[model samples]
Target: MRLDASAGGPSGAGLPARLVWLCVALAAGVAAIALGTATWALAQSPGPAPTTVGLALVCAAVASIAITAGAAACVHRLARAHVRTKASASAGQPVAGQQVEVYVGLARRLQGLVHREIQLLDVLEAQVEDPDLLKGLFQVDHLATRIRRYAENLAVVGGAVPRRQWSRPLPLVEVLRSAIAEVEQYARVRVVPPVEGTVRGHAGADVVHLLAELVENATAFAPPHTEVTVRARRVALGVAVEVDDRGLGMPHPEQDRVNALLADPGRVDVGDLLRDGRIGAWVVSALARRHGITVKLQSNVYGGLQAVVILPTPLLGDRPPARPPATEPGRMPSRGEPTGTATASSSMAGASPSPVGARHHPPAPPALTRAASPATAPAFRDAVASGQAPRDAGAAGPLLPRRTRQAHLAAPLTRGGPGPVNQPAGDHDPTLMADFLRGASSGSGEPPAVRAVPRH
Candidate 1:
């Protein structure tokens, strides 16, 4: 459509009036020169004045038309060249490269910051025992992951290779999970059990980025509360991952156009895609091209678009074989050795049963050389909740029952001094509360009933 609109040059309907005036002036100049030359020739030839005048007028008219045609052609050709140059510039080869460089630098810095933030969040989540606090930390970590993903995409678009690489091939299931974790609506994404396979260490990051873009798009465009299903399987060529969503599918023309863009993303204008709000597709294409991965979109049986990405054989790696348990050389099996089942059964049979209503307790934490510090409360609570040993040396003391902060409050109660009964009923009475707690802990003296005071 843009091509058709720009086909006409200065001579077309949209031509500026000034160009027409310039052509007219040139033609008039040519006509005047032709008339003067004709008059001079007539004077030299000694012909009839009327006939010479008539011939000169005819010559002038012919010269004007010829000059006008030549000038118009030249103007049209120049106009066309100018338009082509402008179009090429607007398509974003030079300008886009500069912008991409700037963006790539910023993205790299952002990635570093987000990476550190994620590490902090992980530590906090591990140390915090409250379920609510842990949930909030998880949310923050997820957002950080998303930010890192955007930074990585920007770097990829700028032709920057990923700095981090896995030392060994990662399982296909884990890759998909990592991708899914970056999406905003990841909870709605349902991943089918993938066949056993591993992605090559070099290409795993790109593959994860590619799949993340696809899954994000699916989750964004799918109907609210609908699940976006992702499936992976091994194919003859390599491994294929499919993302299906129940969104409104595009028309055949739009699909073809997008497919063509993905097929040869280099030919498409990055600026144009950015303007059209299709940067996701461009990012996916760029990543796929980098790793020799193939991405295609087609209509699925469910009347939605299905994006299928094929990781070529070079990007796929075989799962390493499981290593056998290390054993002493030349060691023979003993007949007295009990199998796993027999050992478990014997242990269970020899264990004594507990009495009814008795509370079960975890194994005692290892004793600390010194008492627990006040700061160790959080770590101690986390370990106790998880049923694990105290992580801190000072946290071991918290595992055993002890009263550290109530000694001052309970001193007067233990001394059996007379209660301050003359104090106002409306005022807070700490002595009565402390006495109640002391009696409860000691399981001896009856707790004194205190009158309830109403708030104003």
Candidate 2:
């Protein structure tokens, strides 16, 4: 439920008026007490009968009560007037002929705000490279992006804009992969793969915005270094995308807050969590409602928040479209190889294939290293050979040149072993390696795929 300035509540802008009323009540009580004491003193001093003093005290008490009541009523009325004025001002603003216009304006403003906020964050990031600082910056950036996306989604819906038919079947895998890449820049986490193949649906920009908000919110509230898993699957009726995070689970208070916000979009205090100064959730909800998409928010099995967006099959129609055949040709039926030959082939595949003589010579270590061989060289080479590692994996060695490596090695290993490996190494389990490679290579490899339609 939204609670804005116009909302009739003690905690709103009328708080000041409430305080005034409270003060007035206190003063009246004090005055009544003083008057009673004076009346009692006068009667006891032989100036007036004790009964007169009592009567005077009663009158003073009645007067004080009446004054307090009047003051409260006056304060209430004043608060009501203040609220009405604010509401009138908002309503008096010219209403756009189309919701789309309003939405587009909101989106543009949000975009500017986000761009400015991100620029500010970049400066902050350069000033302090601490992990905590970086994490916070990422959180803020993610929030800003979410707000911008929500605004954009609203704009799309307000305009009754229909996305162009995808030129070809969408590479759902590629879309999700790109999203994961974008998310990784700020999230101190990894995204898990979906259980099924690419989800087919209406390819549009709204999909990206929906996924971004869900993933971002999950990351922001999740525990540090936890993984956020995204899964997409085709249900009998439509497509479902699930984003799961293993962070601080949603508590009743937060749930209540979100529910209240959804109920009353106007009451949202967007400034609290987002740097972009826009109400992200309200925009998201509005967009979702406009599109007839169903969004379910729930607690994840891993004790974190899970957001599921189910886009009805055909997304815009009733029947699922036929999927194209796979790109790769089917494998030929293989005759059983002799045991010895099979063993040799397996050995060859498992062994490092780089020519021995062609191996790159290890560069000399710096002053700090003294005698130690740069341990990371082998690992770095192995990572690169794996073929699907993130770009950083290939640049890891040179980025740390020999000198920097020595410095890193010399620094007291605060935690045993090297800093947590950001990406899996070549030696990681084959299944995991395959998944990572798939995600790295294609933008649509996971849930929350990229927009399949080309933007005009």
The candidate maximizing lDDT is 1
* Model 1 lDDT on a 0 to 1 scale: 0.52
**Scored by Cα lDDT, where does model 2 land?**
0.41
lDDT of each: 0.52, 0.41
Off by over 4 Å in 1: 1-99, 320-456
User: How far does residue 421 in candidate 1 sit from its true spot (Å)?
Assistant: 86
Q: What is the TM-score of each candidate against the true structure?
A: 0.50, 0.38
Q: Compose the digit string of candidate 2's lDDT tens values, residues 11-96.
A: 23345544544554454444345344533455356432344434444444454434333332332333234234445657896433
> Measured by C-alpha RMSD in angstroms, how accurate is candidate 2?
23.4
Q: Worst 10-residue stretch by lDDT in candidate 2?
A: 331-340
Model 2 Cα shift for residue 15 (angstroms): 27
Q: Report the lDDT tens digits of candidate 1 across residue range 182-266.
A: 7778999988863345676677777887898888888777787788999986444556899998888667877776777789965
Whose TM-score is greatest here? 1
